[model samples]
Target: MFLIPAIVLSQRPFLIPHPLLATAAPANASILLSGVLLSLVVIYLASKCGAEFSKRLDFPPVLGELVAGVVVGVSALHLVIFPESGMEASDSVVMTVLQWLNGLTPDALTNVFQSQSEVVSVLAELGVIILLFEIGLESDLRQLKEVGSQAVIVACVGVAVPFTAGTAGLMMLFNVPTIPAIFAGAALTATSIGITSKVLSELGRLKSKEGQIIVGAAIIDDVLGIIVLAVVASLAKTGEIDVTNVIYLIISATAFLIGSILLGSIFNKTFVTAVDKLKTRGNIVIPAFIFAFFMAFLGNAIHLEAILGAFAAGLVLDETDARNELDALVKPIADLLVPIFFVTVGARADLSVLNPALPENRAGLLIAVFLIAIAIVGKVVTGWAVFGQPGINRLAIGVGMIPRGEVGLVFAGIGSASGVLDKPLEAAIIIMVILTTFLAPPFLRVAFGQPEEPPANGEPSLEPAAVVNEA
Candidate 1:
């Protein structure tokens, strides 16, 4: 009877337990819940404050959010670090606070920390998915169709130039091995559609001709990046490329995008009819999320990014009569979630690798500079790759492609995990990603010309109307 009571009380830690029960009480669940809630509070506060400050400084708000994440993250405060980044529970200030407040043992703290980081990571993933979906809805299908060829050319050039040049340069100049060189080259090929699109949307240029071409190219770039990653990752693990997997990714990616667009009309009509029948409160928005999440699920299930499916879903829904209402509904949701994506991307970037004072980092810093130069020049030239758009903002298009963002980090992470990249090479790739990701936003604004003066209220008025009305 006493044993049963002690077991019950241990699980419910809030209750005042007998002396034996108190020592056995495990608070991992409650600690996880508390840590997650606190993490969210930090995320939201940092996001809004960073965005507001950036906006005031005449920079893209996303850049501010990224910077804010860097401040609170591992490099500085240690408030929001991740386990995958090789950080421990003790390294996290938030975890420390929770442990102190809840009197958690070290073992319990580790479990709570891991669980909390995972929840935040999942939230960040969803944030990007929602952001892409919003971008899709704002995009005009006809415009995308018009610029499809140019976008393809840009994407192809962007991938080919960087891969060839970076791989050959690394092997010849740095005396690097073939596999690691190939991996670094592959890292250069990624263009963060999320970052570029968010910046484009903020600049109120999402519907412009240049914007269409950039968005379209970025979409194709993502698909191509996935294929490159698959090939290189296979090479890393087994020392041979898997042709069968490569072909499957190519075929499936192409089929998925084309098929999604082709069947969009049918999906739209069915969606509208369903919304008309539903009498519930979330009749419109809830069903929309269901389709979006399902499409996202399908994308991940097939080895592609979930954002692609969400984006494809948005394109389908853009044809619906409910587009306007749906856009309004989604904006608040995006505002809430999208910052998490941007902030986490910033947080994961460990800037200590760039410190040249350390003997080990000096070599990596030199390689990073070379990679950065190549990264910029390779992507910039893609602008001139456009054949038909005689008067397009070619420079803006090129600049838009510069940010490697989270996609580049994925390459670095895989390289590190596979044991193909040494410290200097891995640090070089990460530094390259960090520089490219930070530089693009400010440069992109300049490429488009000086930003317009703000209204009396001081906000840039980044509504959908602004997106549609931009020249």
Candidate 2:
């Protein structure tokens, strides 16, 4: 009778157990939730701040987003605090929720989350592809033609130097496998064209000779980066480097470029002709998106990056005629989706694990700093590639492409997924991403002549020139 009473007392709702009992929920779920919430809040605040800040500086709002992330991440404020004790508690809660949602066994929650992460990753990839396509649509091919040789030189120099520096730096510091080092090098090759373009536009130089060169070079850089990625991925899969395969990839990329332009030109002519004939009443955005997706799918079929397809599709659209409509259709989707992409990036950054105290960890941080320096120097060097143009600051143009942007993160994600990068290496890359992105805007404002304050007469002393090529 006494034992039964004790058992009944233990089962009582008000019964107090150990203090630790209150911490039984899993911590990872809490951490994830915190990260998500914090990221969203930071992005919102940063977006507002960026609008005003960007007027005085020559950079995109994404730079501000990166700065906001760094502030919340381990780099600065360390605000997204996750206690070690909370991990078990958070895990338990997450497991229970997962089991309830999918009828999964306790043992299966890990697998379920992994599966969910994969799905999210695929969608993120799709988002990037669409983003790239939109960029291509906004691209001016005529500018590329005009800047052809100079752009080629700038891109080649830009890619080669940083890639070599990154690979060598990793090999010396980490002693990692050759393949992983190669991937690391490849990751350094990207230039966030969006950020560069935004800065150029802000400086009222987007139509200048230097601006055209930077833009053209950025497009080529994307092409080169994708080709390198394909080769690295193929090597990762095969575990052996095949010279013939690498050659084939290059050839295939070349073919894709030529073919895409030819096909896109024909398609653009036909589509615009149809739009004219049909006088379609509804918005053409859906059709445009469909075409973008179609091109993305085609690129995937060819083992090319889906973004290439989106870009080709964009190139096909007669931007001169359809610019306003296309912009209206795409901008809304971009506005909604792009922030999610950046915030997701911040949320996914596992900065809590990074320890700068340990030698290996310190090495990783140093590697990040070294790579950033290399990235900056490499682009600056490309400015010297401009010949017979003394007035044009090729250095400024090259420097403009230093920020790695979304594509760099995408590369890091691929490396992380492929096991080419361990957690520390991944963390290091994230730091590099944040640093390059955050530094560009302010520096770019200085590099490009800053816009003077408006005159009292309501007209600025210097008027922004219309779209004109500087000889």
Candidate 3:
């Protein structure tokens, strides 16, 4: 398949007289197009190397991609520095990597790359949207329904304990105001469902009873996390949290989710027949992918995370007859983009917030460390809250829920952008997320015991018949 720029430029034009020519090369040369492409190459290479290194050490590949981003991002190498700091970036020995590859001095280099990050960030968000959609495609609604009660119970405890603990820890001890405290607490919610599922898949236990429980609880946690983020973000954005507005936000989110799922599922199957009449053959997932983006846009308009909408779209289509074909098409797209999302997320972390020389920042660091502890114990306790399934190892379920990778970053990123979470708090949250994310795979590995080695062929093939063209 062709790369992304063509898709991004579609259906858009510049001046009325010069529409299609807008995409043609400008009269003067610019290095930015080449720089961004090279940046992606560096990012992909760094991510794969890091991911493989982590896998060799019995860790999840997500953790490695994240670390690689930080190592090569503004936080470490200053390979992709901002223009303001580029003048004084010489202290970083890793700056040489950027110099040797791109062949530009720091300040000039930064100016060239800065314009590209905004575009890269937009693409990264798209990557995450695709990931959530792919996850939804793979999930079974009936299984989620069966575990609803247990999931609700565990999700509530998981959200509540950490939120209260995180908020209070920041407020009472550090004298943090109401808004940042709330953002800090909200970050602790939402166990990384993608990370947990990956670990379970590695262990080949996703079909197990324990795995089912964890998946259900994580879904519920996503719902609860959305509500908390909505409420807290409202308080931060408006500087006033009315009881009625909070109620309205909750009701609106709930209604959107329920209505989307019901109407989406109905429309998915019924409309496909009508759409097919105008159809070109072998284009099943084109409509599915477009609908996923529409839902994501709708969710944003309603003040919830886009992933929630994308996820709902997944659930809507999972029960349809076209599920298999849609999944086959979307998986490759997800695979191509998901690494960019994860790597950019890590690389964007600004480690300067934790500098000890800044007296005020020290308190935030302490609060971060404290929040990490609370985040772990909070999720761990949920395992004990499970009612049925006596044979299930509750600890494994708890450990599975520990990683807070992408979802936690989404919450923190919004808070930082909205001016609710300051640099220290945002950086601290990033550290806490990294630590929490790193712990989960090792914990799951130990809890589930060692995995057996693959046969002489190394591993089985992933390509299915549907993924290949039948000439």
After superposition on all CA atoms, how large is the RMSD of candidate 3?
7.2
* Location of the lowest summed lDDT over 10 successive residues in candidate 2: 1-10
lDDT scores in order: 0.83, 0.60, 0.68
Which residue runs of candidate 3 sit more than 4 Å off their true CA positions? 1-30, 80-112, 174-179, 206-209, 237-239, 271-282, 351-361, 406-427, 450-471
Candidate 3 lDDT, 1-471, residue by residue in tens: 001111112111110122111332341014555555666777778778888887787676667777888787767875543322222435333334445655766665444444445445666778877877776776677776677688778788888888898898889978888889888888898787766765665565554566767877776676677667657766877877667755765687679877977786678767478556655854677778778899887876765657777878888888888787787788778767877876775776666665778887786687778888988998888888889767778888788778887567666767776788887787778778877876787788787775433345866422222132110
**Which regions in candidate 2 have their CA more than 4 angstroms from the true location?**
1-59, 69-127, 169-180, 198-205, 233-239, 277-281, 350-355, 358-360, 409-427, 451-471
Model 2, position 46, has a per-residue lDDT of 49
- Ranking according to lDDT, highest score first: 1, 3, 2
* Highest-TM-score candidate: 1
> On residues 1-471, what C-alpha lDDT tens digit does candidate 1 reach at each position?
000011111221112222221242355666677888899889888888898899889898889988988988877888888876789999999999998898878887776777778778778878988988998898898889999999999999999999999999999999999999999999999899888888888887877888888999989998888888878888998999999988988898899999999999988889999999999798999999999999988887887767888899998898899998998888888888888888888888888998899899999999999999999999999999998777889999999999999777777777887789999999999999999999998999999876443466977554453533210
Which residue pairs does candidate 1 place in steric collision?
none
Of the pair 1 and 2, which is ahead by TM-score? 1
